[model samples]
Target: MATKPDIVTLEALDAFDALIDARSPSEYAEDHLPGAVSCPVLDDDQRRLVGTLYKQRGPFEARRIGGVWVARNIARHVEAWMQDKPAHWRPLVYCWRGGQRSGSFVLWLRQIGWAAAQLQGGYKAYRRWVVQQLAELPPRLAWRVLAGPTGSGKTRLLHALAAAGAQVLDLEGLARHRGSILGAWPDGQPQPSQKAFDTALVAALRRLDPARPVWVEAESRKIGLVQLPEALHQALQQAPRVQLQVPFEARLALVLQDYAWLGRDPQALARRLQALRGLQPGEVLQRWQVWARQGRLPELFADLMTRHYDPLYQRHLRADDARATMLVLPGLDEATLAQAAAQLLAGGLARVGS
Candidate 1:
């Protein structure tokens, strides 16, 4: 007699040797549990074909056809992917809603003498857990918001703090955006889907100790296309802030270094600047584009800082950060930022958290 496969909930996930996502490749690509390996029981096309058959020919015909395809795929996986598994290997498998794909896979693995289990409610259950934890976790931990104008190197400082052994949550880093209109990564890496971002965020949060204050950059509710969960955004807003004050020239130099790709691909920079078109006068916008086309980046960057970014910062960011503890830095070089980070870890920023 075959041993019955176990069904496990979210809490039991870590006990397994491997996490297998049995959903289609496309579904796995969109979002999945952190550290899950894609071992789809049905390929994207196969899943589509099976669903269409179910709709057109009724459940009986669909199952008859689908079972053959599923059996062949499972055998292929066992041969190609699981051949090296030891006798005692245990794996957790999940599909969209703890349904047929994962159930069948777990059944086969159990018959083969491995301890395999299906996720109780599959990816949907994991997603719900992510949402609930995100809603609840941010409130319990203390947040330290880093408030600074554009080009002030908030992200760099976050890195510096992390290197100095401080608890840091770089939301923009996780979102794959810099939290600005021009914030798309220069390397052309696409941002993760909102679901993926949430997964990454929660995983990062889970790693941190709640007893320590988490330092995060002050950001708008949305970072590129991903919105911070409401609880987190609220916690960040309510947290004490550390204001960074850098001189205009230092900021300009930092921007030039950070966005050096803008200088190399001025046309790309010109196109991105178009996002600010409605806000800036047509002539001003036209001139900026012309400067971009001409490769006159320093002048274009300075104008953008003085005219566009500065005004917006004054109007928006300055209000709530009025009482913030100010750290006036002379430069944004790595050594300088590292020194500042060290001081912060030395309890320079403790009062604000308190």
Candidate 2:
């Protein structure tokens, strides 16, 4: 007699053939197991109606209605699974918890002579593991901070370093913000919640060897609206920094290149620039607004860099005593910038003197 495979434990989940999330679409969308695919057992409308029935009627009546829906959904998934399943496929199915939903699916799979396992404690268990990993990251690894002034191309440099085979963590990229007042992208996507941020950071760290250097951008504790995990923030504070420098004109050009989309909505650009009000004095703010209206974008950006951005950067530099490594780019051309980044990262440049 053949025996069925039991449900998977958290540690063994990564090796599972497939991770089927059997929660409703809405439930799945709210948050889910990191790599699980949605093969919902109940659609959103059906799930809501069942919930209402369960509250309004007796448990038996609710279960009877739910059972019909669940069986239909399971049959569809099973057919799909059969088409996709390989001979060696050993699926791990789960729902909100290792409850009736997953149990029913697992039983059906077993009856059909397919080897499928449920996830013990389901998605909730995975969330717990993610939280634990992130909360304890500081004690497990050392980080290297890559700090730079505004428009210094830190994010782009991080990507360049990654292409050169260095381990890099792009914090702003993950947060979906460029880390400035005008940094929001056209999509206006909000960053993931702090819990979600920690989950992602921990996952990135897991891929790297802790003994090796990992590069991350120098940033404030908050990137736009998302606050960094405290443990990782503390690790960043202690990490040694490699500072980058570019000529003011080059930086201005880089800023323009970064925000090239702004050319289409000069009014929106003006508004975003105006958002910096009260941070600077009224006269300085008005002057910048005039430059913006006159369409002197380069001059406007230069003024902001000198009067607002650079001063804030200087303060952080004084506090950190960062080891500034100057890699001067001749121009903002992609090739020139990439070459300059490569030279610095490849240890081809002399160390900058204070």
Best by lDDT: 1
lDDT of 1 at 68: 89
- Backbone clashes in model 1, listed as residue pairs: none
> Clashing pairs in model 2?
none
**Each model's lDDT:** 0.88, 0.77
lDDT of 2 by residue, 1-354 (tens): 433357777777778777888898877776677787888878999888888998999778878999999999999987775676766777788988788888888888777766888888887887788777777766577676767788877778778778777788888877888888878865557777665666677777788787877888888888887787778888888776677766787788889887777666666677777788779998888887777766778888888899899998887674645355545545556665567556756666633221
lDDT of 1 by residue, 128-190 (tens): 999999999999998988888899989898999999889999998899988888788777889
Off by over 4 Å in 2: 1-5, 86-88, 188-190, 193-196, 270-296, 322-354
Residue 73 CA displacement from its true place in model 2, Å: 2.4
lDDT of 2 at 282: 86
